[model samples]
Target: MKQLLFVLAFVATGLFASSQGAVKKYRVGIFASLYLDSTFTGSTYKFTNQMPKHILPGLDFVQGALMAVDSVNSNQPLEVMVYDLRSADQSLDKLRSRNTFDSLDLMIGSVSGAEYRTLADLALLKNIPFVSATFPNDGGVTNNPFTIIVNSTLPAHCEAIYNFIMRSNPTANLVYVRRKGTQEDRLASYFAKYNKGSNGSTLLKWKTLNLNDNFTQTDLIPHLDSLKTNVLICGSLDEAFGLNLVNVAQKIYKTYPMELVGMPTWDGMKDLTKPEYKDLSLFYTATFFNTGTVAATNFTKGFTDLTNGRPSDVAYRGYELTRFFIQLLLRYNTQLMQHLNERTYRSFTEFDFRPVLNSTSGKPDYFENKRIYILKRSNNLVSRMN
Candidate 1:
């Protein structure tokens, strides 16, 4: 009887090993700017007291992705590997020389500049899905269907802003305020190109107010009309300019019902939530937003429990996108590209992915998320208006 029990246990152990081995395992690569070498030296700490501000975003993003990988309680086998692109001993050629990406099923990057472009190109060459997690620009990687840009481009943001204006308050008095600079002028050009696509001559009429050093309410009141709703578009990305506009608007908007729309960068402006700016109605565009859904709420709790702080937008993107694409990788395997637009995993934000095409060739450039959320702030509280 003892021999029979030992034989049964031996058979059960063999079966468990067989099942574990039979499961298909996928190799996933996550590249972020962790700056590991700079922070650590042979297990010794470099900055003992506090982490540098430059490395915080990358650390937070990687932490979120690690949480996501742990939360994936599926039957499929997943092997995740994280590479620090900003490490002292790291470079694109060094990574490639080691054949680090040879067996990768998918790659995700939280990097920009040359690293981003290299990964995108590598994904194209290898026929693997390389998810550009944070960089807003396309980085000139054209005709690559394997590249998926999670962060919408500047032009997409401009289009979303124009669409919001036309749909929300088309007949309202439109005023575009900007400060003169190279980047600011370029943004103005983007708006002009997108705004011209609408039908009718008088359908979209906007007057530009270029703010200077001597700018004040006396210069702004001329464009605002007290009789109708004044929709002010802050066309520049300057933080000081945005704050000045808020001060001026607060003084004038008590008389006029005004809504101030800002650029995508304004989403990161925590100062807008202060008590002094509470009364002003403000709006801005962002790629990802958590509105306290069950999943999002749980993620926040889990993140806070782990780090004792709330997760930032980049962290949330890392968690959501990692979970999302890994699920797809397990389910669809190598054919994930065919279902790029499918709404399978509903995370914090509903991603609206559309194919971007090359201008001259008219072929598929890459997949991009065109949807931008317009968040509204009033009375010291913020909510998604769209």
Candidate 2:
């Protein structure tokens, strides 16, 4: 009788332990801008366009990924608390005051630069991880070892374009055409730095053209002839100016043929499809997501189904961000939170968040850069370039 009782007690203890080991939980906070007013059918939660309804598709993608994670690993179940900031006008205040953070483990936001700064400050103070889908201003939040930027930065895009130009046309003389704007100035500065090397000596020369003032290609005819350059790279974002440049360039092509290089703003600009741009080929650098690769296509399909066909940029942002976070949770479990401060993590777009520390001070100094994709558009067809 004593041996039978001992066996029963041992089995009960094992069963309890196994059950406890099979359950895991994580609390997450989603803070977004609500710019519109609408309600989900049959749900008490009202949604707005403050964050753009189109972004809902991406959000749905993330939800689907999370569900998949939960099914595969019953131990880790995610509890998400969403906060809308349209009415309050101060999302950070709401986030900080919320009782949810007491149990919250991670935060994801698709706010603007100003809002991102507010959240970054809060995340640093609380030692929590905050991921932003868009580019955050450089000075807004660095040094917060926990802040992660999923989108490629503007400067990184500039560098990628510079590198592509150097590698493809090592000795090609170039003419830089730009409108008088801060963006154009920045690109010019980057190109100057890129051409400082030995082989780049006189390899590139630029002629700045202000569309507002110059207005016509005839204004640039003299410079084009004097420079004797056959390549024109545009660094302006104004659609009107871009179209004007393309039109003028096409007219000139009848006499002086030149290849055109452009910035990522040209990606979906309808001006490129006009008859004036037919003879001109444009190339630019963009993150792989914009080009719609295999992974992007699959994600888009899953995202569309989840959002009931409402197309949104936020939806993709939400979906990919959630997918990546879920993967980290599955791989690292509770340890995933700890790895937030690390240098890098595998993302749909390859990302490395490893901190760069000052050698003597032993403090984080900067973030190591990652990869970017280059795209080329010719005759209305866009494709990855090498």
Candidate 3:
């Protein structure tokens, strides 16, 4: 899903800048995969003036950031510069040669994988605050206090899931339904780690139900408790598995009280709110969700008017990240790290950047957002439970 990202081209715009002032101008760099090179063949447009579906998310992110930039009513000019990692000849050395980091106060990227790693290293070297807007994984980044992961990691999700289960369903029959795979094992271990760390007690001990890749309803029904609520945490990011799990769970829900919590990837299941899943008590964690605030409502309207369609969560995330971090840079200036966990400003999601320690080094490698939203959908209505 994160592929097809190397597409966006660099675009920069002027923000109010001042050489000397209490609120001086700050340069901000936004790196995204726009794939500008592939769009044109020496002058003729390849796609014929139409944006591809694959590139829309990144572009939407840019649009959201632009909207936030426009909304800024301050003297502290944010000289925003956008870079397309998918450029024909773009490289870290090329970017470094430009000596751009010398002027940048903050850097944000909706990038992932190797691109994320390069930028993260640059942030570490320059002591610049790098806001990773969309990537979920840390890419093995360690000993880097400059990196801030806005999208919480998988371990963070597992911890949040465990906390939700123990707090809300202390006595519920907890069953971890996972397909046999390395990823599944890793996910299970995360929950296990969290369970072990919680006061050295496995209060939320779960009955593991390992199934084949092509698991059927018969494989799950035997483990579910009909007499009590069965809280099943699906330990897989596979959408196919999640769909099947939901289908089987729905059938079982008719006779048993069941709640199925899915991984973060399940957020893209648009059909969850359909008639079939209307009464399904589905749970999932996400970094952000539309809270229907006046600002959010206006943003939705504006986004629809601009794109002629509804905006995705990435769009909201882009706006929130840009607006939030810019305000932080403006307010704290060089001392933004001192108040990294402050919850004073919010756009859609609440970010609490807690330092993530590297296991081998026993020191903070990076900061990640630990705050999670347990969104529950029941009776055709969705609400954030925590």
Ranking by lDDT: 1, 3, 2
Which digits, one per residue and each the tens of the lDDT, describe model 1 over residues 82-143? 77676544566877988878888999889898888999999988898999999999999899
Lowest summed lDDT window (length 10), candidate 3: 1-10
Ranking by TM-score: 3, 1, 2
What candidate 1 gets wrong by more than 4 Å, as runs, is 1-24, 197-202
TM-score of 2: 0.74
- The residue ranges of model 3 lying beyond 4 angstroms of the native Cα positions read 1-24, 41-44, 197-200
How many clashing residue pairs appear in each of the predictions shown? 0, 21, 6
Which candidate has the top score in lDDT? 1
Per-residue accuracy of model 2 over 225-294 as CA lDDT, tens digit each: 5333466777776666766777778777766656677776776577677765665767876554444667
Tens-place lDDT digits, model 3, residues 244-296 = 88888777788878889999987878777678877788999998878899989
Question: Would you estimate the TM-scores of all the predictions?
Answer: 0.90, 0.74, 0.91
